[model samples]
Target chain A: MDIAQTSPAADYPATARTTPTRHLERAHYDRATVHAILDADFVCHMGFVADGLPVVLPTLYARVGERLYIHGSTGSRPLRSATDGLDVCLTVTLLDELVLARSAVHHSVNYRSVVVHGRATRVTDEAELTLALDALVDHAVPGRAADCRPADAKERAKTAVLRLDLAEVSAKVRAQGVGDEPEDMDLAHWAGLIPLDRVIGTPVPDPAVPEGTALPGYLRHLG
Target chain B: MDIAQTSPAADYPATARTTPTRHLERAHYDRATVHAILDADFVCHMGFVADGLPVVLPTLYARVGERLYIHGSTGSRPLRSATDGLDVCLTVTLLDELVLARSAVHHSVNYRSVVVHGRATRVTDEAELTLALDALVDHAVPGRAADCRPADAKERAKTAVLRLDLAEVSAKVRAQGVGDEPEDMDLAHWAGLIPLDRVIGTPVPDPAVPEGTALPGYLRHLG
Candidate 1:
């Protein structure tokens, strides 16, 4: 049975598609790990077959419970084709650090990434669509949906959201120091990790805005 | 003729798959822009058709003029299949800022992303393979590839590098300020860009480093 129909399990049952072909030790199937990695990033690369060829597109996404919502215009080809349930695989990677090993082959990045494979269906129900839209905004910026004006009926009608259940999901992570070989440990080379992070910067308000529009509580952190 | 076969073209010939279906104004076909976007990021989401299904995997990559190289283990299934020329699409996105509009529907991210569609073949030639490996390491950390020990014969044989010429490629970028509607500009909501960037941190040396081992000059900037 598909895991989506059942209650949330402690771990996502790994399917053949979810299994890692390499670095088995870094693969993760736990629901917490999968969800956490997905929540950390707001954008995802969605791959889908078009004319029997693979196409990868970057788009905004949000994780709502056991389902992932991808935002696209109703006029988009992928959105139109997804109405018939398109096969899609979405991947999100958060690069944490650059691991510098003693040798070229051993060098790697410390990253938390999640790969989700599933068939996505277009969201149609009004209430669910509203929920998905708000979730999309809040996922990227907490409390952002409430701060901004809700989409009008016309705006809602023009937008399309695809929901892919997090049934076939797995997270692969490598968050450690340099994995230099024992023999290479004595090599005259620096081996370690260079920490990397994406940081939020100060807000740049639109100049046309009324003079004293206060920044919302959600954006005050950046202010 | 494919752009690779001819001398370097100013733009990649956009195919049916490379053209954006929506927001065509944001699509870029210039080779310089595409190359710059690919060079700025070391990691990309590689999409390929596996068993007639789409699979998106994150991996490190580097651009060598009109060609892009993806690194993988020799034993990896995708790498194995690429030896026979697998249809692949690789996408790299560098997020710049979060565009917070006055309305929910208009919210977006300021990003530069390049997508390449090609049939990838495994690089088997000794010179090209070595160049790909060095390019992969140098792309991620400039000047560091020369500082590390070159891979031995055994290690080189264990690695697989896939070459995908940038014939059908396009870049999409959104770099401007919040695109709020004129009517919504007066709305009592903050509308602007929240600048975002990934920054590199100081290096953390391995525990076994000798007492007097000096950090290389290339890494002194971080020190």
Candidate 2:
């Protein structure tokens, strides 16, 4: 994950609202910046307007090249509405640390996030759906797609996978420790960063497994 | 955090879109279910429509009783629009485990999430603002509010704190292990759950602090 910290002077075009009104310097429009954040996160919050009111749902997603794939039941409102070519916004955020500051007003969190705005179209083609589902599984656990059984015809019929192209996107990032004013820097309060991270613990095998079956190699090397 | 495992039969009404369309049985409107998930999560994705486009931003928030407090710069778009009594949706999600099943379609992530749709109003009264700021601080690290300096008049003027009542809210949760069909349960593949959690690491002291200052007791007690 060797990410270059260049400024947001890249040529990637930004949508009208994706441009940040406040902290404009924190807004990035590079494809590398967007791809890195998307690949690092497994879950995203998909926002769409249902009945003229905005609805946001947390769901699993995977990023393959410039496209993001999301799967859900055909009976779900979000999936059904998306298949009708409804506009949607998908966001992925990874919290890095808690920024403790001298002044309460300056307290904030350090995070990396990517927000994508576009129309989500359902994937009705069976061949593309197979590739999309494989990308999703492999995204969570690399190489696990080859290890698991493919979805049968009946299972595929009941599932709906929505695809969103990453054309209008932006990444707002804040990685600094504290942004306190000079006057409050000397205040007698403990100020630093408490790093927060999501870690994979020791894997627990299923009870139905044959006795003494060893864990897969890819899962062992995930962390 | 003693939450009852009751169904959604409670009288807490749900908005039109918050009603689950697919798994109606997984929706719970009890105040306990919503509060517990809110208390456990430190950040939330706030969804709002800005200039006819839906925008979602990840921000820090705190749940105080029936009210949720979110603070940001007065210059930020979300905070300014929220203070103007605009409609907004805030969602908090905690991923419990990754359910690995025999078939790809059955793979899912177990999680608990709460979504609130309501109007946000500005908190301008000085006393209430102080209390809200304290809650936001203590929410991250309990009992640290009194240990730090309060927001001065100038800092409060530049910051905006918005409050949203938890009236139209619902908690969608999936806590069980894999729900594979009976025919696929006996398939020759490894199946189990991999739990996920956020853990706080050893606090790195601020370089400006006096040498040999011990870590706070509350932070040490935090898992």
Candidate 3:
């Protein structure tokens, strides 16, 4: 395995903030659990306080070892506010299935989610910034980073990158089928899991693309 | 139409927090945009400050008219803290497609997201709580509320509901295909969109479910 790949699943010590306030059984503190959930999804909802009011924004992010990197225009409010090293909460959730129970009280979704709470520090070093950008590209379309030209001086200058060390992070997962009460077992209603998944459809070519350009090798297996 | 249903979209007045610092072209303040995105997604990431640190948790929610209702165990920290009428940020995002660009800088995801900032008020009135609970059930599976027995007084006593008026809200959408820069348009790489969608698969009946019970009408239409 490449060193750049997430290190083998290890354990992340649980802190007071990492522990779940309820459903403690569903909480996980393993490094592998957190990394697996984060790697499967690119979009994360990042929460931060601005003017004493909470603000959450959806943005793309990539993970490299103990750090998660998020990028955006330097002028973006969330990114700008994050550079000041303010406390932030980043969450990535993958909805696996919708559990439809015989009773309304038991309806729940099968999902895997990781939440990280930490202060986001700006990634200012030029070399690390380049690698973070590459990671972001590869995270979206694996192996496509090397195929395309890297961001030049101007493009790199326009982008802002923030890194949050995955310290106070926890993963919560629910993978079981419908979990209804024993009393509802005899109900004449259908109770089960409606597995939900996101699949990549056929690649649509750009209108101006060259006549013979074919879909890249990495994208052919996306779906 | 049931008055409980979200009313026809109108407009949400923009405030300082609702305004986007960048990508102004993608920011939408119209009520229609906000409601459409909110109605499509079931889980929302709610952010609130806990001990001066931002905490974001994924929770089930439903929309009724101008308010969003989130339900959870009263013992949960986030839910318990929210009842104090503290400010919160709630966000829902739907990932539509993957835009594979010719260059790394332009790679993006086509998505629609709504961000709401407000102080969440605890819902205590019994009549309104029933409506909110019904809305939550229907939000997960349309027509589900009538199919299953209503929550008993004991269940309702165990759950806590918080309502946030959709006052300061904004929707940001990116729906186009690959948007590579002009100079890189002619790059010899394939550039296009790989559409992504979440589809419900065949429902698996619970192991204890009766052998011949047919799937419910609501589950049949989900896929």
lDDT of 2 by residue, B116-222 (tens): 99888888888878888899998987877887778888878988999888878999999887777778767777777888889887666667767776666677654
Report every candidate's CA lDDT: 0.88, 0.81, 0.85
Extract clashing residue pairs from model 1.
none
- DockQ winner between candidates 2 and 3: 3
For candidate 3, chain B by itself scores a TM value of 0.93
Show how many residue pairs clash in every candidate, following the order shown.
0, 0, 0
TM-score of the second chain in candidate 1: 0.94
Per prediction, fnat is 0.94, 0.64, 0.84
Q: Which stretches of candidate 3 lie over 4 Å from their true place?
A: A1-9, B1-9
Per-residue lDDT value at A21 in model 2: 76
List DockQ, one per candidate, in order: 0.85, 0.65, 0.78
How would you encode candidate 2's per-residue C-alpha lDDT over A73-171 as one tens digit per residue? 988887776657768889999998887877777778889999999889998777779888998898887778888789888888888999887778999
Q: Model 2, which residues run further than 4 Å from truth?
A: A1-11, B1-11
Question: Best candidate, TM-score-wise?
Answer: 1
Q: Provide TM-scores for the models.
A: 0.96, 0.92, 0.95
What's the i-RMS for candidate 2 in angstroms?
1.4
| Candidate 2 chain A weakest ten by summed lDDT | A1-10
RMSD of each: 2.4, 4.6, 2.7
Q: Write the per-residue lDDT of candidate 1 for residues B1-223, one digit (tens) a residue.
A: 1224445556677888777888888899997798889989899999999999999999999887788989888889899887789899999999999999999989999999998898999888888888889999999988888989999999999898999988888999998888887899788888888998989898888888776667788888887
Writing each residue's lDDT as its tens digit, candidate 3 over B107-208 gives: 888999999998898898899899999999899788888887678889899889999988889999998878888889878888888787887788887888
